[model samples]
Target: MLGVRLDTELEERLANVARTQGRSKSDIAREAVRRYVELHDEAFRREARRQSQRASRRDTQEDYAFWEQAEREDAAWR
Candidate 1:
C-alpha cells in the first residue's frame, strides 16, 4: 500500500474538493494520479514518435551511394 503525506493546507483543499464532488479522498486521489500518469505517458509517446520521424529523415550509406551514382549520371549529360 502506498501512502502520501500532504501539508495541512493542501489536505484541507483536497478534502473540500472531495466533499464537493461527493467522492472519497482516496478515490479522488487515485483518479488524479491516474490522469496525471496518462497525460505524461501520452506526451512521452508523441515525443517518441516525432523523434523516430526525425531519425528516419536522415540518409543511410546505401541512400547516399544511390544518390551519388544518380548525380554522376546526370553530370555526364551536362
Candidate 2:
C-alpha cells in the first residue's frame, strides 16, 4: 500500500473518475503507471533503433541540394 497527497482539484477529479468507473484510486494509479511504462519503453526502443541506424551509416550527406537550389534562385532574383 502507498500513501499519496493530491491537490484539491486533482483529488476531486480522481474521486469523480473512481465513482464513474467503479474503480478505486489505487487501481487508476496502477493502470496509469502501466500505460506510462509501456509508452516510454516503446519510445526508448524506437530511439535506440534510430541511433543504431545512424551509427551504422558510414557517411553523412551535406545539404548540397538545398544550397544549390538557393543559389539558383538568388541568381534569378538578382
Candidate 3:
C-alpha cells in the first residue's frame, strides 16, 4: 500500500540482483524490510529487559537496608 519512486539506475540494479538470485523484486524488498524491523525489535527488547533487572536489584537493596535499620533500632531499645 506504499508508493515509492526509484531512480532508473536503482531500478536496474534491483532487477539485476533479483534476476541473478531468482527472486521477484518485491520479494527481495519485503525480506530486506522484514530483517530491518526484526533487528530493531530485538534491540528494543534487550534494553527493556536490562531496565527491568536494574529496577529489581534496586528494590532488593532498599528492602535489605530497611530490615537492617530495624534490627539496629530493636537492639538499642533492649
Among the numbered candidates, top lDDT falls to 1
Q: Tell me how far candidate 1 lies from the true structure as C-alpha RMSD in angstroms.
A: 8.7
Per-residue lDDT tens digits of candidate 2, residues 11-75? Answer: 89998999999999889988988899999999999999999998677343445676788999999
Model 3 over residues 4-51: C-alpha lDDT tens digits? 678999999999999999999999888888999999999999999999
lDDT of 1 by residue, 1-78 (tens): 779999999899999999999999999999999999999999999999999998798778878899999999999999
TM-score per candidate, chains pooled: 0.74, 0.65, 0.64
In angstroms, how far off is 78's CA in candidate 1? 46
lDDT for model 3, please: 0.92
Output the TM-score of candidate 3. 0.64
TM-score of model 2 vs. true structure: 0.65
- The per-model lDDT (C-alpha) reads 0.95, 0.88, 0.92
Provide the global lDDT of candidate 1 against the true structure.
Answer: 0.95
Model with the higher TM-score, candidate 1 or 2:
1
